[model samples]
Target: MNILFVLLPLGLVLLAIAVIAFFWAVGNGQYDDLDSPAWRILLDDESKPPKDPKDSP
Candidate 1:
């Protein structure tokens, strides 16, 4: 019975911390570009050309 008082407040504090963290992430632009990162992996990087072994000193 005594443990309920301790556990209840601890649980509420944890929940409050989680809610604050979620809002902080949202305000920091964490979820702004969700799709671009996934699509980036599929796109080929053509900016740099492959170097040949003969070109090395």
Candidate 2:
């Protein structure tokens, strides 16, 4: 009974924060190019070989 009052407001506050964060992300282009990053992980950077410190000048 008493716990409900505390839990309900706490849950609502968390929900409000989540919604605000989602909208903020959308406005900041956070969701743009969602697929490219996933594909990028599978793609290899073959243009250059891994540099060795001993070989570096």
Candidate 3:
């Protein structure tokens, strides 16, 4: 029963720290720009070799 006092407050403090980090990420625009990356992945990138190449054995 005595351990609950210390452990409970420690757990609450850790939870509060996690909440602060989540809010910091939200305020810093970390969630912006979701779709372009998916479409960009489908687009043909010039740096990579062509898919239907004769050299492939």
Mind giving the per-residue lDDT tens digits that candidate 2 earns over 1-57?
999999999999999999999999999999988999889999978766449867755
Tell me how far the alpha carbon of residue 22 in candidate 3 is from the true structure, in angstroms, after superposition: 0.4
Model 2 regions lying over 4 Å from their true place: 47-57
Q: Note each model's CA RMSD in angstroms.
A: 2.8, 3.8, 4.1
lDDT of 1 by residue, 1-57 (tens): 999999999999999999999999999999999999999999999865449867666
Q: lDDT for every model?
A: 0.94, 0.92, 0.91
Candidate 3 regions with alpha-carbon error over 4 angstroms: 48-57
The residue ranges of model 1 lying beyond 4 angstroms of the native Cα positions read: 50-52, 55-57
Q: Specify the poorest-scoring 10-residue window by lDDT in model 2.
A: 48-57
- Candidate that scores best on lDDT: 1
TM-score of each: 0.79, 0.75, 0.65
Ranking by lDDT: 1, 2, 3
- Candidate maximizing TM-score: 1
**lDDT by residue (tens digit), candidate 3, 1-57:** 999999999999999999999999999988788789889989986876668898666
